[model samples]
Target: MNHLISRAGLGILVAVAVVAGAWARSGSGSVTAQAVLTGLLLGGVYALVAMGLTLIFGVLDIVNFAHGAFMTLGMYATALLATGAGLNPYLSLLVSVPLLFGLGYAVQRHLVSRTMGGSLAAQLLLTLGIAMLLENALLLAFSGDTRTVAVSFDTPLRVLGAVADLSRVLAFAGAMGLAGAVWLLLTRTRLGTAIRAVAANPEGASLVGLDVRRLHALTFAAGTACAGAAGTLVTPLVTVEPTAGELFNIIGFVVVVLGGLGSVPGAVAGGLIVGLTEQLGGIYLPGQSPLLAVFAVFVLVLLWRPQGLFGRPA
Candidate 1:
């Protein structure tokens, strides 16, 4: 009875907070609901990117600093394919996903693979080099012009007076589905077992007859594919540029750390929490938003829970 009372009290507190905030903002319940949904929808995309980052970092233990660059590459690929080649943005997945996957496989197999168990400098420098190469390559090709893919077909959805573009909503749904699938894969498949095993203990996994090299390639490829999908999903909402991934990469790293190195659920939770916090803080805090707003939380998380919300205890 005591536990139940405590839980009920917490729930009531949260409800009161929500109601008070809504009353302060507009005194409209529908409007508050709208605000909440808006945050949730956008949070989905952030979660998707965080999931991919967690997967790569958690399993392979290689911090692909270039993960965001891959996402940007996907955005660019989809935009170019959609506008230049006259293909649907969604349909461009066929081209973008494979290209990103191939790039990931090649990079890991040739560069990251060689750096395994080597000096930390090698791993860092390799990924850093890849990031630099991608940024420069994009600058040279796109000339710093910001471009966004327009959804030629869209049906706007209005939920409780809050306007949401159909594309963004679809992207949000896709992200959720993909994240769920990833979690399922991580927990319920042979390949997932091998991947997790390799992540936990590479040498032991190999001793048990798992092919470390192949699994590594697959992990790299899968991570890239997640980034690619995220890029494609968000491209319509934002610009496609060379340095676009920089900010995303930073957030991705934070979300992964906050979620716990390789915990998919943790990633999703962290991403949503970060995303909503950013959105709400941006609105309420005035002049302090996004990067700056989340900085405090970032530091607190690191100091209080170094392993992140769900990260394994060190």
Candidate 2:
């Protein structure tokens, strides 16, 4: 794992150097700076999404195909509160987070928990069904129209000669702050200790008098809450559509695999790397979609480190 992380780190540095060199040769230092800045900010959002995902997988050992659906639900929840109730989008987190958390907990306790210790295929199908159902339900309710929350701080901020949207900066800061808080919860709190214990050894946790099922439900709910927070944060930056969660779903998976299947900090690192790859790719591959570049990096990383950059080697 250490060696893999080192190699990954080296690859990131090399990637940065190459992108910087390309931009320099093109005499577009400002454009390069802007891409890097944009990528980092975008990466913060990705980290927030992926952190929830990693946490769920780490504890529940289930790949939540419906995770993105939860995010879309969050987006709509925030949108409804902001537009209907005249609440600030950021302030909507209070409602969105708890609502999603309760939904997640109920889903896990009533539905997902049944599939535990069963076939992996069963879990996949269940989550995929949930994803489809939630998405279609959203479409029925809101139609395909794109909704957005307008914010006052849409102005651009200058950072080191590069321009960034103020909203994006705020979202980035919020993402980092939330991620840090989650990290602290995991490392410091008793519930966190129980969650970690369950992740490490469910039988052992059970033997230690831990209510494993409750912890699983709580962890899953916590993960969904993170998704809700992310949805709220990005409400001002992106269009809110039923299908809006699809892109985040794809990126979240990429981040999960790249960072390691179950590492929280790894998700953050992977998100930044993916973000950089996206922005730099736009500069280097002028005609291709930036996501294409992200996939290329994903492929290379998978080839070299299937356990992920931060995952323990088997």
Candidate 3:
């Protein structure tokens, strides 16, 4: 009951911030509308990115820092297919998704699984090392060059008197659909039930004959796959560089923290809030980095609800 109230309160607070920001920037209704729409679209991608991080943490309790790198890898893979083989970027998902899934599985099974129940410091170092290795490998392959995937439908669309790229709109729809699928998977599937059981009590789950290690690998793989899909989705919207994922990594962490550490719904809500705060911040502070607004909101939320809006009181 208290959790419900906390969630509602946080929602109200974030909504107020949005309203206040919008009102403050009310000089041009069209610009405000544009920002709001763009922010919501961008937030969908953010939510998808954070969802994977939150899922890994929720089920395996592993802070996988390499998640964004996995995302970058996906972008590169999609780009490669698009540029080299004349394949549609969206169709590359068939390859990128499985590629990331296999890589994530190997990472967890061969490296991360060995560190389970061990030192958190060691786990952090391991994931950090993995991130560095992946980034450097990408640098070697892609050579620090900025790349983009070309799509046939790279045009503009109007919504509510505001103009947005077709790619952004499609990305937004795809992201929301994927997020909903994930939500259903967690709520209405046997695999999800088993995964949740493992999350609740790994030892007890093991005692009950569930293969915890396998589930951990599966969870990590699913998480990375989510990152990969998000990367592919945004390939048209952003430039692809070896270090591109670093910015996303930072944002993912902020979203994960701003949301609950292990809550999927929280991550989604946080992503949208961050996105809105960033876009609106551009209007409120003309010359400042939009992230400044994100941090401000994050700090305010943490100060008010340390465990995050959806996180259980610890």
Candidate 4:
């Protein structure tokens, strides 16, 4: 079995356990366990969010500020289809993934491409506009009502006396599988080589007559598709409201920045770090809960390894 934590990762895990053991000694063992599990699983969700954001920033040299908007689009679409059209929750991936990929591709080709090589201010402003448009569009279509996607309205699963919704388990599994696949693609394929080439040296790739523009479109589309898939997975657990992507957007960017700009593994590890920080910190500290720990870790990470845990030095 793959180890749950790495040696370096284990050190932090141990520190968390020590503090949580204090809580458990006070009759909070079960709560601590639940928090650990929650952190591990929520890490998977954050992994999904960061996978794409890092990819775009890594490959295209564009910070996609609107990634969360595409994520919101996925969540809303899944909610609409699973609840309104009566589609099976799992099967909705058949539609949501492709539909959003196409949208991402078109947006990149027309809007993002136009702003390529421009000032960072221009790119940020444009994507921010797109994010605003998507959120408002969702508000208009759904009337700001909360919606959700789930298999059965009231069936929660019991595992070893811990109660969790089945959909959440499925979401965690789906996110892991997807992240593994993306890691493989980046490490094991020719297209992956081309992507790394561009990320490493865009001008050199252009000298070889590579279709840099097309690759950018593909990379952006793929990143947004990752976000869409994550949304489809998590819509079941969270409320699918217009602003659903807000928190996720903030954290996802933090993860990418923490993980390093272009390193896939950094993104994944950074996500797990965020997940554990939120859960363990919430339990031990209780008052400030997730944020105090999350930002603390973020700053520590940047201070210790400014290039990110796995990101290459720029």
For every candidate structure, what is the RMSD over all alpha carbons to the true structure, in angstroms? Answer: 3.2, 1.7, 1.8, 3.0
Task: Estimate TM-scores for all models.
Answer: 0.90, 0.96, 0.95, 0.91
lDDT of 2 at 82: 83
lDDT of 4 by residue, 1-314 (tens): 13434646775777667656646754676677676677778888898899999999989888887889898888888888987889877777878789889999999999999999999999989999999999998889778888766677546776654566677778888998999998888889988888888888999998998889888998899899998988888888788998898788888977987888877887888888788778888875767758778888788877887888665565
For each candidate, what is the lDDT?
0.82, 0.90, 0.87, 0.83
What candidate 2 gets wrong by more than 4 Å, as runs, is 1-12
lDDT of 3 by residue, 85-107 (tens): 98999888899889999999999
* Model 1 deviation from native, Cα RMSD in Å: 3.2
Q: lDDT: which candidate is best?
A: 2
Q: Residue 211 in candidate 3 has what lDDT?
A: 92
Q: How accurate locally is residue 145 in candidate 3, as Cα lDDT from 0 to 100?
A: 90
Record all residue pairs in model 4 with backbone atoms less than 3 Å apart, i.e. clashing. none
Better of 2 and 3 by TM-score: 2
Task: Return the candidate ranking by lDDT, descending.
Answer: 2, 3, 4, 1
